[model samples]
Target: MTAHLSRRSLLGLVGAGAGAYLLSGCSGDDESSDPNAPQTINWWHIQNTEPMLPVWAAMAQEYRTAHSNVTIEIQPLENEAFKTKLTTATQAGSPPDLFQSWGGGVLRQQVDAGLVKDLTDDVQPWIGSLLPAALQPYTIDGRIYGIPFDVGMVGFWYNKDLFAKAGVTETPTTWAGVLDTVRKIKAAGIVPIALAGKDKWPAHNYWAYLAMRIGGLSALQQAAETKNFDTPDFVAAGERLKELVDLQPFQRGFLGAEYGSPDGQAATMGNGGAAMELMGQWAPSVQASSSTSKKGIGDKLGFFPFPVVDGGKGAGSEAFGGGNGFAIGKDAPASTVDFLASLLTVDNQRKAAQTGAVLPTVREAASGISDPNNKIVAENLASATGFQLYLDQAYPPAVGQQVNDSVAELIAGTKSPAQIVKDITTVAKSQ
Candidate 1:
């Protein structure tokens, strides 16, 4: 339905720019008038791995072939490295022409600093081609600032064989049922959950989802606006998490586990060392790649949305996850915007989806998905009644990091649920 909207209707949703930046070789004027202008667009993205790495490179080459005078520079960096480099560049007032952005409070900070472009008018023509729900992460204060290439939600990726071995009949739909499932799996001599505790982010997912389920989707946004996380709902969320921790559900030495390493979370799940994991759409591919067999546990894998909590405010249909996208830097050439639009064409998006590396943001490109697990995630995301971006990406850097720290402490039994909320509130208010 979103793919058929007219440009006029889409343009009505665009918001005005907040401010302007003055940079050498950059102008607010339209440069499309000069068709032969030599332009080079600098792009930094995190698809440094095999499938997506080559896919993005091929797309750039195709674009270059069509426009002889234009040059597209691509720098593929690992996730953490990309974030560090981008931070330094932004602080130095020299951001890449186009760079990877998750688009939430961080983008809002950049927008306020006038380091990014206002793409309201530039993208309106084809913006409607993307699923409107996928656009929420990029829409800041009613204005668009980024273009999403992929979208998905967090859920349970489990081994069907392992479940049956544990005599678990149904996938869980409530908190109590999830605990029961974990207990059964542990009794069957299988680690219940594979978590990348050393990474901190993976462990934080549990607390974030619990908060969403207990307080409702709006709770985080309300806390962000008021700079207060010290509340009954938030503490209750942590308490619920503590109940899971009490079962010792994670793999042995999980606190030191990495996400993609041979002995880490995905590999553990892929090699059938663990019964399940709570992860995003990319989990399956990562699992396969990290496993010793390099083929993962193919048909043994299954997916289900995060289970609900009885008497909680959140619904089963609300989702919590974020995807990858590109943000326009302030000094980028005018042609940079056009290049970004070109990258999102249905054909290009389909190629990305075919790799099983991404869940396409373009509505029509959804058909390109070859894996059933990914298809299930896409369908659930499409039907979601509410959505929330990853908390680390949705909040300021300091506030986000504080959340990870506090939650980690809570998981380690070093802090109480109430203390964790207080720690988070102290950091959040300072931000």
Candidate 2:
């Protein structure tokens, strides 16, 4: 109960300033009691792409300069690769000292398995400086398990020039309008969307947003609790996504495309080969890094909230996404937390924000976000009426993967709308 915000109120303090909501909990030996000690911190993160990759390295080097006692070994892995490797590592009961964490069901499972470090005492003193809203995802059962550095929601990252060329005058605000927009864009001989089907997870955003719009935030919570996703709402969400899929909206050979590959989703958008892609805050930076010119589409990139679904229970104001954080592993030296704290400092947060690739979790660094696209996302997130962490990060790993698998098959035309729900439900029930 100390976490304060449950899954239902993840964004309760988004626009408000509040004290840190993480309260006291059971304890472990205070590893951070020592001021200086020779230690090697093993860090694994998924900001392997440029812009962020260099930014993270710079931060580590800065930390090292401040404390010569630490030798930090860094590994920047690709998203899918990080997930696969992390799973294997955790199963083997060996987790990196500091590793990237999305902080929801996965963190909870880690906590339950005693694989994660209890950071309640380690983080509370300085946690108040960060956004209370951002902390909710990392808090489980009255203890702090991780600390978020970036927070944002999923939305459409579109190429304005392509939209204009397609003669779509405005961004769609309804599901029907989005379909119409796609049709128009496609007819104009432009790929309506740049999708990374080989990655599977990118395609899942469409279905997740659709379900959020049609079923409401409560429906997702209910399904998670009941382990049943066969409801009419979910089925309709799938069918609606199918309507867009059948329009042949994505780039050619999209099903075989990778997300950060040279010819993949971000690059396609950056190269002006597509009108849009559903993604989170980092889209623009990734686009720039993956693009041929390494400058991306620059100001041509724009963002919009996922469109509303008419007659659906969810409001357009609700957001679906998650942010990035670092969790300490069970056996990490106490200096690990001190090092983590150093990275989350307001000055460091401001530094990260100025790169325009991150949305600051520490309130003081909010002014550092100068990228207009990121600002748009930040404003929308601040005013979000509700929030849903990405489902893959919200549910148990197995259940979450099932959602990605089933939705990807639906997008690939290998699974029916009804069958995808049945399959997801089967996995959920088993879990």
Candidate 3:
């Protein structure tokens, strides 16, 4: 339960609506003012694979061509490696000129240490071009700190063919309905869900979504603020998840399953070995990559928002997820901000969206999405009633890791729901 913001409140933060904004401010006119200014922008990002890796490189080359005096040095690292390297760099007080950022608790820590620049004034002129919800993660204390390139939410990525076989004629819109669907799918000899239990973060999503649905969007935030997750709503969230676990809907050896392995959650779902998975915008691409055919069950794939719980304080429209963005280091060249702006242009964003690898943050770039699933996700995010960043990202890293550990224990049948909540509460208090 990250801090929640209503759509109207988010819109107000941008001053103007997204449709009215333009990318005029992002052009390198300031660099042009001083033609011979030699500035090398050091950019570190995590899109180290195709088609995004090459796409990003091309964008950097294009930028360099436009501003002859500026050289953009791109360091594309793998996810874990990037985190490790960035942590080392930041700790040594030499953060990259511009690097990948997810925003929320981590970004907050960076801000506290004065490792990142405040982009509020620099980006305000064109910030509105991005969907308001997309900016929620990058914003701290109502101040903008990063520029988002992609945004999305978590939801059910299901197999329509499997549902049909299970006689589930309609998508479930309530928690009870979801259970019924799962039971039916199990009865039909299909694995109801694909879970990467070995990867604790994946299991954490279920408990987090349950909390959001039961305790409302602000529940996690309230718990974090008070360092108390032992409330009735949090307990109920665990109990409800327990009900799902008791059904044994996941695949064989699910507790040890990885996410992208050949026999993991994505592969299981991609190969049609499991009926559904709860994941973010990147699900389809990963599924395809992990499948035996190296091509997922394409048309059979479908998506739906997580179901609502009876008598819950939360609505069906509150979204839970995060996105990719770039944060500027404290001493980055002035032109670094401009270069970031250039990367988020409608044209560049549209190119990224075309790869089906990202949900473009720029409103105008959304039209470039040709995939129906991506379109559905984008539309759902656009109309989301409330926005919450992923719990692992929204809270301190220690607390977040505790959440993943506690939830994994609950799923493994070793810890009671009440006990898990108490464990999480203890970690939050320590944080």
Candidate number achieving the greatest lDDT relative to the actual structure? 2
Superposition error at 61 for model 1 (Å):
1.5
Q: How does candidate 2 fare on TM-score?
A: 0.92
Q: What lDDT tens digits, residue by residue, belong to model 1 across residues 1-431?
A: 01111111000011111111112232224334354576777888776654566677778777777876666767766565677788899999889989999898888888988999989888999999998877887888889999999988899999999999999989999999999999999999989999878767777888999999999988998999999999998999999999999999999998887776668888899899999999888888778766788778999999999989999999989999988899999988767888899889999999999988789899889889999888889889878999999998999978887898888888888999999999999998888
Work out the TM-score per prediction: 0.90, 0.92, 0.87
Candidate 3, residue 318: lDDT: 91
What is the C-alpha RMSD, rounded to one decimal, of candidate 2?
8.7
Candidate order by TM-score, decreasing, is 2, 1, 3
Q: For candidate 3, lDDT tens digit of each residue in 41-121?
A: 778876654446667767777777787767666766645456668889988988988898889888898898999999999
Error of model 3, residue 74, in angstroms = 3.3
Give the per-residue lDDT digits (tens) of candidate 2, residues 1-431: 21121111011111111222111121233445454656667788776544555566677777777776666777766667678889999999999889999999999999999999989987879998989889889999988999999999999999999999999999999999999999999889999999989878888899999999999999999999999999999999999999999899999999998777778888798888999999988888777766788788999889999999999999999999989999999988767898899989988898888877789999999989999999999999999999999999999999999999999999989999999999999999998
What candidate 3 gets wrong by more than 4 Å, as runs, is: 1-38, 68-71
Model 1: which ten-residue window has the lowest total lDDT? 6-15
- Cα deviation at 210, candidate 3, in Å, is 0.4
Model 2 residue 111 lDDT score: 94
**CA lDDT, every prediction?**
0.82, 0.84, 0.82
Candidate 3's error at 412, in angstroms?
2.0
